[model samples]
Target: MSNDRFSMCLASDLFRVKKLKSVFVALILMFLILFLTFAVCWVGSNLVSKVEVSETPSIEGETAPTITQEEKDGLLAALDSVINDSLMGSGAICLMEFLVMIITCIFVGKDFSNGTMRILVSRGANRVHLFISKWLTMAILVVAYSLFALLVSGILYAFKNDGSFTGYDFGILMRCFSLQLLCNLASMTISLMIAFLCRSSGSALGVSIGLYIILSVALSIISTVVSLSGGNQDWMMFMPMQQMNVAASAGSYSTDQLCAVIIMPIVYIAIAFAVGVSTFVKRDIK
Candidate 1:
């Protein structure tokens, strides 16, 4: 196919799928998650402020207590710390991304199960092109969702917490977004691959969810064992979810854990994409 024709074909397929109710439902869910994150941040920041106020020292003589600059700084730091810890820490977004992965699998698998894939392929829509286009579209959507979630959370945090935003802590927010995006992409690719492998939406969802639960359990066991050992739980850093937790911990993780945070997601994404492409290429459309 010529470049122009390929582009036209891709555009047509994208529009068709984009108009589907499932796509809109997915977007709505993404926004709902974003709103929930904002709500979590807002409540967490307020709680931190309350705790800070309760802990503030009263002046010895003056009826009106004056807080020092250092105290103010401490309060702000406490709020930021608590809010970040509650919303972004412990791989919370990673779990959310796993849910999104299941949604992506349903969408992809339904296309195949409902005979859309065969119809599209019969219309000279190259399988590789269709797969790549759909993957890219989903990745773009996931990235957008992550960004919206981050932005809304940040804005809500600032609004409810003295209208102050910390420049230094913005990096943590960005990292959370990046981690969620990468994790979503990795899981989406894996789900697509599974859908192709199983050829049944129900089977694909079951297998993907089952593997996710198994991996979570195995990783938790490994992390627990590593922590119980005499060491600093360095071995647990290799797990993807653990790495994401390290990324979200703000200052709790070591340099090695930080590096793992940067590496594991990339490895997962690469492997998922490779497997997805390979399986799609070999699978029988009919």
Candidate 2:
């Protein structure tokens, strides 16, 4: 196939994939999740601000303590902290990413089960190209979703804090987003690999959900146990979701721990892609 023809085919496949009902549904669900996250952050920040103000003592001569510039700055900072904590913490954004990963996996796995892979490959498409294209599409979706969530969360935080907008913690927000993106990509890749390996969407979905639950819930418990037992909790650094919280906070993590968080997801993605492509290349797509 000519280069131009292959490019056209790739574009066509992407367009069709984007129009899938599942894609629309996933995007709508993402918007709803973002709304809920923003609402929660707004309420939490307001509550925290009220509590802080009530607890602060006024000087005897001070008349009801009007809002000074310093106090406004403090409130802004406090609101930012609340917003960051609620949106990027283990409970909210992290769980949303996990769900997105599962949805992406379901879409990819369904393509295989429905014989879409056979159709795409039979149309003069290389297996590796097809795999990469699908992966790229999923990456775009994840990034778009994360950015939307961040924007909504920021807007909600600002609205709740007063009508004034304090700038976001861009570094922290980006770091949190990067971690979530890596986790989603790794999870989706793993699910695709499982689908290719088993040649069954049902098996792939089951394994994907099982792994998500185990990694997010079960492993966390184990990590806490190890930490309480005086064992080095260093291994938890490699868990993608754990790193998401660590990175979202303004506090610094050790260089080694940071490196592990960055490296582990890349390793997982590479391995999953390698296995997926190898399997796709050798398998009989009937």
lDDT of 1 by residue, 1-286 (tens): 5566567656765676567676566666655654565566556646545543325566689665556556766766775655565456332355456656666677677778888878878887777787777677667656765666566567755765578878855776777667556656766777767777777778988998888778889887876786787556775656655543443563565677667766776787788777777887887786
Model 1: lDDT of residue 115: 88
- Backbone-clash count (model 2): 0
Q: After superposition, how far is residue 217 of candidate 2 from its true place, in Å?
A: 4.5
For all predicted structures, in order, the TM-scores are 0.76, 0.77
Alpha carbon deviation, residue 11, candidate 1 (Å) = 2.5
**Alpha carbon lDDT at 206, candidate 2:** 82
Pairs that clash in candidate 2: none
Give every collision pair in model 1: none
lDDT of each: 0.66, 0.67
